[model samples]
Target: MYGVNTYADTNFASITLDNDVFVGKDNGYTNGLYFSLYNVGVGLRPNFWVSPLLWTMPRGYAENRINVHSIGQTLTTAEDITQANPPEGSLPYSGLLKYTNTHIVVGSRFTDWVSTSVGIVGPAAKGKQTQTEFHALIGAEKPMGWDTQLKNEFVFGFSRGRAIRVLASRSDTMDLLAGGQLSVGTISSGVNAAIMLRLGQNLRDSYPTVSLASSRASNPIAVNNSWFVYAGVSANYVFNQIFTDGNTFRDSRSIDYDHNYNTFMTGITYTIGRDSSLSFAYLSSFSDDDTEYSRQTERLNRFGTLTLVWEF
Candidate 1:
């Protein structure tokens, strides 16, 4: 007999020519458009204390932007590029880039201690490349001692083609994420926090090779493989009834730093009404080194989001 939803504030920013990341001198406009949606359908049953629930969230965005510069050039074909030898000489180049992603999930809870979910991630399209993913998860919350709640969850997935291959092709690709969280004190009244950790692996295929002799062999260059670990903590607060709490702060966003890696995010949310809310968050990417490959570097890009909700 209830429903909820939200949308965050839109943002626009200019890319300064003095930005340190660019090789030479460059200038352009960079912007991002993001949105999210969630819906839940409940069915009452005579024998159950809680109704059977079906929930789904479809969220994604498209970024239409460009970077014009005098520092980079385009390779006409894949043959012109090499893993060991990248393009040299400063040549000006510019083009349009676009990307989009969607996720459909379903699940139900038995009693209040256990729940399960399974979902298929549609293909994520970027320019001429596309990728797909699938995932399954199960979690439980059990009372431990007098005031603590023990929470645990496990998830697994399989991906193929350019989607999984793209990240695997990177020198710092880490695949697979596994972790759990634990909390103490009441969850509805807020004032609780939990820590989590995740580990990843990079599965890179071998490059083409040729045999020089009966016992000697030569192999062509390929991308590098790597392993990574991530850790973080989060908490929430409520000033009204748990479900109808509009003055509560919460975190409800996912963060992924391309190429099989995880991110740690810390943020707060404030609900303005039954159909309105606002949130501000800071996320940091954790990696093993500052330099991964020659073409990319590990630099922290900070983000702040203000969200508003409307329900029907």
Candidate 2:
């Protein structure tokens, strides 16, 4: 089990400062704040659930993802802000800007080397009701060579689904994610390395995903509790706009510029009792166009993550 520590790395929760696409209720005025924000998620992972039917029958998971951002100005009420438009860079950050999501998934072993999972997602923000997501995945993992301490084997797997939204980023809600990760040690304890390529024919084109930033959310099948300090990098050739004003995929015209970017991430985790653990990570983005750059120099574009997890 694990969670991201946003304050530790400001870049982890940066919000988009788009001139348009604010409060879902009123796009003309934006509640989207500066890039610095925080995100926290908690979930219970797959535990042995079905043994009678097929031995390694079922493993289920449930989680809630939350993003917290600073809204602007004390005097600028929601009604007051609707009348005037803030300039491109200056926003009236007043209260807390937030996005909340809940997700659940269940998986079962199909064979000694393969398994499958299915799940649903529900997201809500500022009283806005968004669409729910349904997804299913199939995968396999097995040991490589025979070494005692390095007894753990290399793992290879792939998944495909529709509406698989990894992060709150609107641009990230792709039709599928088709990549995997590798651990030098065992899954629980190890120096890990991973790469994921985002693929999609359709974009959800929602507010937070497209409006605030272009970065994708956490990758699927996260590292287990045994992992300590680990670092990884990511690069993507997004066919879609990394950031947009409103419509999502079509919000911006077809352009090849600033479509490719990279991310560098590292984090440490600590275990709690026998079933739970907490973790923190620092992530940075390298791109010509990213939400990382903010007019509020006081607010560093530092990125961070905190997550908490458990098993029943």
Candidate 3:
């Protein structure tokens, strides 16, 4: 049976920041910030609303369970934000503020996760103010299209996934992990799979996969002696995406949602001490031909992720 402290290494608080600035571009998933708490049940009770979701999944004898809670905001913008009304078929300005709770079960070589979220979309998410003020501070052009951003609406999401360590070096200095995830909800519906290779010290203490979305749970490393570099590739087939599909229950600026995407990510992680670590990764995404929506599909989507985690 799993012990109460089976996941003590993951009892942490983290903040993640993502932006295109690191890649020298400034549109399409432009910015995001998130704060998260992991292994909440270790020191505090899980949120009451997340209890029912946990009840649905029975625990296994060899697995230990934990709760993760996260809150975040993300912004997406048209290619040209200087225009009060972006060109026809261009990506629309959109914002999301969401809170998510995840149930995780960890075994010796495999981990499973289920998550749900609720969020507000459109002007209520403060996309306009945040971007405009940020641009001014950076001496960049003020964005001018928030007036046409997605309308106010509530969105919900659910996701499930699992990761497995497919191979490991006899010396425990390297490992390979394969993972797949499915998501369904008003925010987006998609399936994605990825494989990652990690090489460095204390590979066993590192998180298995890199998240496709920066606003979601990301790579978390435990312990002060761990350091590694990892690279991975993932393919996604998105059936629906609110940022492109627009408002779920109302008429709003919309575009033909891109259906396919391939992404590559590489990064390095270093633990600063028993309680803290830093991670930085670069991601580049490519999509197959879709509608001529401002020609966005032909361009590469690039961004950088920076994360800081501290264990209690």
**Most accurate candidate by lDDT:** 3
* Residue pairs clashing, model 3: none
lDDT (tens digit, per residue) of candidate 1 on 139-191: 21211111110111111111110111122224423322122211121111222
Lowest lDDT block of 10, candidate 1: 208-217
Segments in model 1 whose C-alpha atoms lie over 4 Å from true places:
1-30, 43-262, 292-301
Model 1 TM-score (2 dp): 0.28
Give residue 260's lDDT in candidate 1 (0 to 100).
23
What TM-score, over all chains together, does every model reach? 0.28, 0.33, 0.89
Which one is best on TM-score? 3
Number of backbone collisions per candidate, in order?
3, 35, 0
Each model's lDDT: 0.20, 0.26, 0.73
Decreasing TM-score order of the candidates: 3, 2, 1
Q: Distance from true position, residue 60, model 3, in Å?
A: 1.7
lDDT of 3: 0.73
Error of 1 at 160 (Å): 13
Over 1-312, each residue of candidate 2 has an lDDT whose tens digit, in order, gives 322221121113322232221112212122222332433343422222211223322233222232333222100012123223333433221212222221122111010111121111111121111100100121211111101101111211111111223332354333222222211111111111223232331222111121112222221212223333445555543332111111122221111233345556554544566444454555554665445232121121224444443333
| Reference-based lDDT, residue 176, model 3 | 90
Better of 1 and 3 by lDDT: 3
Q: Between 2 and 3, whose TM-score is larger?
A: 3
